[model samples]
Target: MTMTTDMTNSTAPVKPGTLFGIPVGELGWFASLLMGTAVGFAAFFAATFVGIISIMAINTIGHHAIDYSLAYKRIGLPIGLLVIAVAYAYLATLWTKRILRKA
Candidate 1:
């Protein structure tokens, strides 16, 4: 037995738009870039903050156990910030898509 599917009937149509003379398909790329920039900025700041704290703790405390604890503490903030930024970017993308759907 042979089965056939209608490939020609399975494709959806594309919508068109222009932003400052750029095509709508390019908007998805633009949105991705913007999200990446935001996340990168968040990570940069988080890492800077964590690094400064870790340095100060190591200089002042100067104990092996305390150093390990401080290291973990210093890492915690950046990890949390990265998680939040990723979630925010995901939601932002969904929101953008929803808004675009209505247009």
Candidate 2:
């Protein structure tokens, strides 16, 4: 029986230049930072909108059961907002990585 040992490493070292067809590297870091900040701002705006809607709903529906439901809805807002934030962050990271690969 002949045994073959795995000797080849498939992972390639990151080169400083174009990566995945986009120009990046150090510049990519700055771009990613900017993108993250922009996404954060957008998330904040969305959260604010949701908050306003929740407040209006609470004001309009003054029943006890409705108020309890509103509280539950408000609790969901933060989770939804967090999901959005994480998705945005992931997208930004992916974009940055692609750009870096190209650069």
lDDT of 2 by residue, 1-103 (tens): 9999999979766665445744433444557566555656566566656766676677778742344344335654565567557755665667677766789
Q: Positional deviation of 93 in candidate 2, in angstroms? A: 4.5
RMSD of each: 11.6, 10.8
How many backbone clashes are present in model 1?
A: 0
- Candidate 1 per-residue lDDT over residues 12-61, each given as its tens digit: 45555433454433345456566556666676666657766776777778
lDDT to native, each model: 0.59, 0.59
Q: What's model 2's TM-score?
A: 0.41
**Deviation of model 2 at 59, angstroms:** 1.4
Give candidate 2's error at residue 91 in angstroms: 5.6
Q: What total of clashing residue pairs does each candidate reach? A: 0, 12
Colliding pairs, model 1 = none
Q: Give the C-alpha lDDT of model 1.
A: 0.59
